[model samples]
Target: MKAALVNRKMGLFLALAGILALAVAWWVEHVLHIMPCELCLVERWPWRILILIGVVDILLPGAAGGPVLWLAVPVLLTSIGLAACHVGVEWQWWPSPLPGCHAPHISGHTMAERLASMPLLPSKPCDAPTYLIPDLPISMSMMGGLYAAGILVAFCVWKYRVAHTARRIFY
Candidate 1:
C-alpha cells in the first residue's frame, strides 16, 4: 500500500482505539461505579484529544500530513506524562493538588448529608492515594503504567510510519 494510505489506515485504527478506551472509561465510571480520581479524569482528556486528532486525520488525510504529525507528538507525550503522574501519586512519591475535583470531603454537612453527597463528589480524590481493581492487589494508579505503555506503542508506530514515508519520498 502507498505510504499515505498506510498512514490513513493507522490513523483510523488509532481513532477507533481511542473511542474504545473512552467507552471503557465510561463503563467503569457509570456502570461499574468505579469512581475515577482527579488524575484519572485528567488522563482521559489526552485520549479524547488523540481521538479527535485521529478522526480528523482519517477524514482529511492531506490536512494530517507533516504538520499534523508534529501536533500528535505532543498529545502522545502529554498522555505519557499524565500516566506517569498518576503512577507517582499512587506510589505516594508526590502529593496531588487539592480542589473541588480532588477534595476528599466537604465541610458543613451532617452525617446523612455527607453520605448523600458522597456520590456527588468526584468518587476518588487525588490525595486519597488508592485505586481498587477487581481481583487485583495493585491500585489503579499502577494501571497508569499500562496506559503509558500503550501510549508509547502508539507514538512509536506513528513516528515509524511518518519517518519511513518521509525517507522513502526523499530517496
Candidate 2:
C-alpha cells in the first residue's frame, strides 16, 4: 500500500514536470516570441504521452497503476537522448536527422508571395541554439538533457527505496 501511494505521488510529480516543461515552452513561444526548431517540437511529444500516462496512473488502482509510473523512467531517458541529439546538432557534431532542421533558401520570389508561403511563426533552425539563461554557456537543449537525466536518477532512487521497503514489509 505504501509503495502504491509513493508510486501515485511520483506519477503526480511526473505529470507536473511534463506540464511545467510544456508551460515553459509555451511561454518561450508565445510571450518571448522564440520559435522552436523541428527537433525541439519533436522532443515535446514524449512529455505529452507522459502526462497522459501520469494522469492515468494517478487515477487507477494500485494493481494497475503501480507499473504505469515506471514508464516515466524510460520516457525521461529517451527525452535525454533527444535533447542530446539536439545538442549535437547545435554543436555541428553531425548532420541533423530531420531535414527541417535547416531552412531552405528561397529566392526569386516576390515579397508578398513569400509571406503567403511562409508559416505564420517560422520554426527556428535546429542548428541555432536558444539559451534561456543569459550569459550562461548552457543551451536549452543541454539544459533539457540535464533536467531529464536528473529526474530519471531521482525517480529511480525513489523507486528503489519504495521497492526495498515494500519487500521488507511484505516478505
Candidate 3:
C-alpha cells in the first residue's frame, strides 16, 4: 500500500482509540458517578488533547504526516508523567498539592456552622483513588496509564510504518 494510505489508516485508528477512551472516562464519571479528583482530571487533559490532535490529523492528512508525530511524542510523554504522578499520590509515595481535592480542612467556623457545613465535605477523601471497576483495584488515573500505553503503541506503529515506507521509496 502507499505511504499516504497507510498513514491515513493509522491516523484513523488513533482517533478511534482516543474517542473510545474519552467515552469510557465519561461513562465512569457521569453515568457511574465515579467522581474524579483534581489530579485525575488533570491526567485526563492529555488524552483529550491527543484525541483532538488525532481527529485533526485524520481530517488533514498532509498536515499530520511528520509534524504531528513530533507534537504527539511530547504530549504522550507528558501524559505518562502525569499518570505516574497520580499513581504516586494514590500510593502515598507523594502528596498532592491541590486543595479541596487532595486535602480537606475543617472550615474556620463555630460548632453550629461546622455542623451545617458537614454535607459540603466530599464523601470520599481526595487521597482515595476512584476506580471505574472496583474489583480490579485500578483507579482512573491508572487507567490513564493504560491510555498512555495505547498512545505509545500507536506512536510506535505509526513511526514504523513511516520508516518502512521511506525505505521502500528510497531503496
> Regarding lDDT, does 1 or 2 come out ahead?
2
Clashes of 3: 0
Full-model lDDT, candidate 3 = 0.72
lDDT of 2 at 75: 93
What are the lDDT scores of the predictions, listed in order? 0.67, 0.84, 0.72
Residue 82 displacement in candidate 1 (angstroms) = 1.0
Model 1: CA > 4 A from native: 63-66, 101-122, 127-138, 161-171
> Which one wins on lDDT?
2
**Model 3 weakest 10-residue run by lDDT:** 99-108
Q: Rank the candidates by TM-score, best first.
A: 2, 3, 1
Model 3 Cα lDDT, one tens digit per residue, 118-154: 5563644456887766489987777788778877877
Give the best candidate by TM-score: 2
Worst 10 residues of 1 by lDDT: 98-107
lDDT at position 124, candidate 1: 63
Candidate 3 has which clashing residue pairs, if any? none
lDDT of 3 at 52: 69
